[model samples]
Target: MKDSFCVTVTGQSLIKNDVRQIQHKRFLEVLDFLRQGNVVFTNFESTILGRYGGWPTKGRYFDYSRPEMLDALQTMGFNALALANNHAFDLGPAGVLSTLGEVWSRGFLHAGIGTDATDAMKPGRQRHGGHDVSLFAMDAGPGPGNMYAEDRSNGRPPRPGVNQLKTVRKLGVTKESFRTLAMLAQELRTSSLELTNYAQPDDPTAVIGENELNFYGTVFKQGSAFRRHVEIDPENAGEHLAAMQRAAARGDFVLAYLHHHHWEPGWQEVPGWVQGFARACIDAGASVFVSHGAPVLQAVELYKDAPIFYGLGNFLFHVPAEETEWSAREVWRSLVAACRYNGSGQLESIDLLPIVIGGEEETAANRLVPLAATGEVARNILQGFAKRSSIFGTEIAISGASARVSLAAARKVG
Candidate 1:
């Protein structure tokens, strides 16, 4: 019995308020798109495991309501979550451990988390459409892990106070993340590791002679296990290639949930090492690759049989009334394309599914709730998604049935 199926994979922006509320609202939105054979999946986009992870003072630790939040997501039809995003570290090491326990408790599938790098980069497989496919996450750029709590209390660390920009959103990569990227860039810049043209070998002052502490270009010692920057090293990347190759031979299809290093700030939309990442994945036999961490929608081109969505816009966000550009609709302005792997074992269609966020009540807190199971309220949501989104871009206009964005009015993309 060789069966094949399709699942809609989406990225989440942020979980601002009570974890439970955001989870509830998100669930409703997903239910609106559920089909008998289709599954809805997204990033949890938060850290609401327990109290030990919350930050002191301004650092809210960006927790959503717990147990209830997971229930709401399950109720809303979201089956899986990718924990590879930047916020996974919101509560620090304990936060991550807590989240791991939370996801397991709720019976949700998650990837991109662990006690260390090896665990975080490990892949998991799911049975769908009568076949099994593996999914994985890799931090391919520079970004900070969750901010550390400044002080400890009740066996919990104090949260790093919210810096509007840091607290509002995560673009998935940081300087540490990028240092991992720099090494990979070396792979592309120099086909052979011996290319000394860019990096001189003999000159005492040639390459700055900086000690290779680790991938992040920091200092490293013989016994040190973890460093500031970490990524899919040559050995790990090689292993992933091998695993992907095997999956292609046995499974019906292959997908890579790759988060690469950013060349620019998060607000601006563009391909961030996308051409390189997608082509590499396809060469390794992947059927589709979803690139995230951009503020707006990017182009989707079919490379071989696999399709690449440069960067899907925000499906959810916390309203940082302070930062105009990071709002939901602002990221939702351009139409986002979904790659559907129809009943056939091949890529089938790419259609625009306008992302819907900002759940019921219209209050900042509702942004934390999951959508209703009925999701009938979503139609009303799409009607205003564009206009509210414009608050980040510019003054938006919603007329007739849909939102119409103006040139000078849209949020500024830096």
Candidate 2:
């Protein structure tokens, strides 16, 4: 006989209220499906209060929710959580400590935020269906202070924060654009002509060339225009890869997740580095690569037969009343990814459950809850997924309210 396992991964959850009152028929069906999986994972997108600390006072703005809601989450069948989002440190280290204790006390497994760099970067381990499963999470979004866990430094202690994939950004532009900027700067400096149309760089120093300009180590190749790009820091990304590799070497199935909001021009399209990083994670033995924080549905790809969800959108988002964006149709729609693994630890298939947030009436009285999409809504959601996934040559077939992708059709590499 062969052994198998199943896991369902959802997106960011801003659970501000208890979920015990959920009694709708369609919504209950989705919850029951979630309970059928061996592991249910979600990204906790709010800070758990250690004390009576109210909402954010000075730092970055984020919703503050009571930690008691953990009970509701567990009751809803979420046994695992990723805590590397922007709100993880909204209340500082005490909040993280409280959350760590609460999650552990409730017998829930979580990773990506902790007392220090090591604690935050360590994988959360669980045994399911005669196999060890490890979950490693990180945040690739940009932020300052407490956003990234710090290691011990020269006479400085390690600071508590979230596991981070720090990235280096570079602005790329063509030589023609560089020359135009240089000429403008020269005119601005030589002549006291103050122009508002042409924005000035922080530094007035300009290095212009006929072929190419190397201005203060910022390279400008022969191109058309300017665009910003990012590369994951080698040391930071290497540490995460090593962790996943170690977990796989120990015979534990590894699920590596990241929270990132950096997208391409469109909300659904991701940058090239995201694709590269997902593929590299699979190469390092990750069974799946899950990404969120965009709060919008993105494309899904099969890299090396492992599922890569660029964005899962919101699963349970009930923010403050001022969060008007939640009313948008896109933010209220997402998919629940159910991944099946075979006896040999190879992916067998993927089932996508189309879900719509908000109630059927779409009124203010409707609270935040994910209901199963039916009829036209179901077809549209699945169609959008198929269209986006087509770019990766992955086809999704819709049946009822669910879409599926069998591993047999997934692209394989030599």
Best by TM-score: 2
TM-score of 2: 0.87
Q: Candidate 2 clash total?
A: 0
Candidate 2, overall lDDT?
0.79
Colliding pairs, model 2 = none
Error of 2 at 86 (Å): 1.0
List TM-scores for all candidates, in order. Answer: 0.60, 0.87
Mind giving the per-residue lDDT tens digits that candidate 2 earns over 1-414? 348888898878888888778899888978987886788999988778965343452442566678778888998899989988888877777677777878888987789897888889999998876778898989887655445677888997887778888765456677767777667656765676543323242222233355444444343444567776667888889889988999999888888899876666577777789889988899999988899877788888888788899888888988777767667677878888889888887788889888888644555566578888888888888899889887987878788879898566775432
In the range 317-337, model 1's lDDT, one tens digit per residue, is 664665554444445333323
Those runs of model 1 whose alpha carbons end farther than 4 Å from true positions after fitting are: 16-30, 35-37, 51-65, 145-236, 260-268, 322-329, 332-338, 342-344, 359-414
lDDT, candidate 2, at 156: 77
